[model samples]
Target: MVEKEGFAALVLRLRAEGISDLDLLTAVEQTPRSLFVPPQFAEQAYSSRSIPIECGAFIEGADLAVRLLANLHVKPGQRVLEIGTGSGFIAAVLGRISERVMSIDRYKMLIGAAQRRLDSLALRNVVLRQADGSNGLTGEGTFDRILATAAFPSMPRFLAEQLVSGGVLLAPLMTGEETCTMVRLTKTGSRFDREDLFEVPYLPLVPKVASFL
Candidate 1:
């Protein structure tokens, strides 16, 4: 269980890093990381760093995850798509702000575990699916915001198209000479402008199949 003091410490730490949104802080406080991580690592759930979970996968750095989510500016009743659901912790956070959330993961086991946990918490607004996230939640319609937890060599153009005008797409991209850079891509007329935030290490985004030219 995450006690108040521990949660407060986390908020303070994130505030030090320039995240001062009280709503974001409350979302972090309300979401239980213990429910996301494996049973053995529950004690370390509220810490700011990542921890190894089952199948050699790791939970995200709490601060980094929070920062990524901050970029979403999630509003009540907005539809959001999350790539690389991981332990579903971020999904849970988004659930607090959005009317509906669709999160995808390639690994079946991770989705299964996350589903059970989300059910236990009565988080019905979010859907977890086992699929290729790079596909950008096809048939789900355009989204108000799209967030990718995984870093890839390049941002998928489909994801860019999926974002509604005035919406934001946040992901970590591998730019030249940089292993990972968090990018904020906002759609304009015919092109999108990219703004880099900070360095991060995230799992690679799943590749998409293409038709032969």
Candidate 2:
């Protein structure tokens, strides 16, 4: 069973850890982490640690998700794109703040599960799809913000083109065989300014066809 006080404490701890965005904090509080995790691990859902979900994916801990959201600086009425939709937790949080969120995952099972979770929460602003995130959403035009929950060998070229000028793109850039660093790229004119934020581990970004076998 999950304790309400424990969950509230975790949120408070995240605030102490520099999550100053009120909206993001509220989203974290509103969305129960247990709902997004495997039922077997529901008791540990609010423990401020990553939990494994379906399709060999891990839902980022609440603190990490809040930190990423803070860096993205999502705003109301802004279009956002998320590369990985694991458990749809982050997408649901973004939907609370952004005008609309388009999330893509290569795994069909994960997409279906995430979509159901978001729908249960009545988060109508998010659209979930199963597609290769590396290529981004073609023919969908540009987005005000783009985020990748997976790590790539390096910054993807296609994502840069899909971002609107002055938009922010946050993703984990692999720095070593088993290590990665979070990078923030701000699109400026035809160029993007890169800033290395911090180190974090994430599943490698890959392009895979959705399978329903």
Candidate 3:
């Protein structure tokens, strides 16, 4: 009962802050942030703050996910491809609203942990995989929405190609030598129209799977 009230409070706060999407708010309210948070960071799970997870990675603040997903404009019956699955929090959110969610991460440890969380919630639409996040899941076919949790210097062509026509890709890119800012790209024919969202620091999308992790 307390948990329900806590999430309700969060949803109201986010709505007051202009995150008015009902689906997004409901997903946030229904999904237990604790499921994706480490036991040590459980207290911070529902806050708009990033918290450390396993494999030396940190899940982004819930506020960031709200902003990113708001711009991603995910909808029912859409397929989402998520790069850098991390704790699979975003992937789980995508799964709640989208038809299918294919999330990949370089660290097997992270994927394994995320799988457990998703399974606990019975989020069967979300498929967590341990693979090179930067590889773009070449043969996995196309997606209606593509979201990369990791940042890159620029939108990689390989990842962009996986999007179907009129699809949207949300990712953070290096705006300057060392400055990273997230952007939204909408695929139109052979080109994409870019829209700068906000600046947020993110780990670079590195190539190859972590055989050691």
Report per-prediction Cα RMSD to one decimal. Answer: 3.4, 1.7, 1.6
Q: lDDT tens digits, residues 19-107, model 1?
A: 89888778777888778887887767777788876655688877778888887788887999998877888998999888899998877
Stretches > 4 Å off in candidate 1 = 176-178, 208-213
Candidate 1, 52: how far from true, in Å? 1.5
Model 3: per-residue Cα lDDT at residue 28? 72
Residue 54, candidate 2: C-alpha displacement in angstroms: 1.1
Between candidates 1 and 3, the one scoring higher on TM-score is 3
Find the candidate with the highest lDDT and give its number. 2
TM-score of predicted structure 1: 0.91
Q: Which 10-residue window in model 1 sums to the lowest lDDT?
A: 204-213
Model 2, C-alpha of 127: deviation from truth (Å): 0.4
* Cα lDDT tens digits for candidate 3, 10-114: 677677778889888888767788788888777677677788888778998877778888999999999999989999889888899999999988888889999
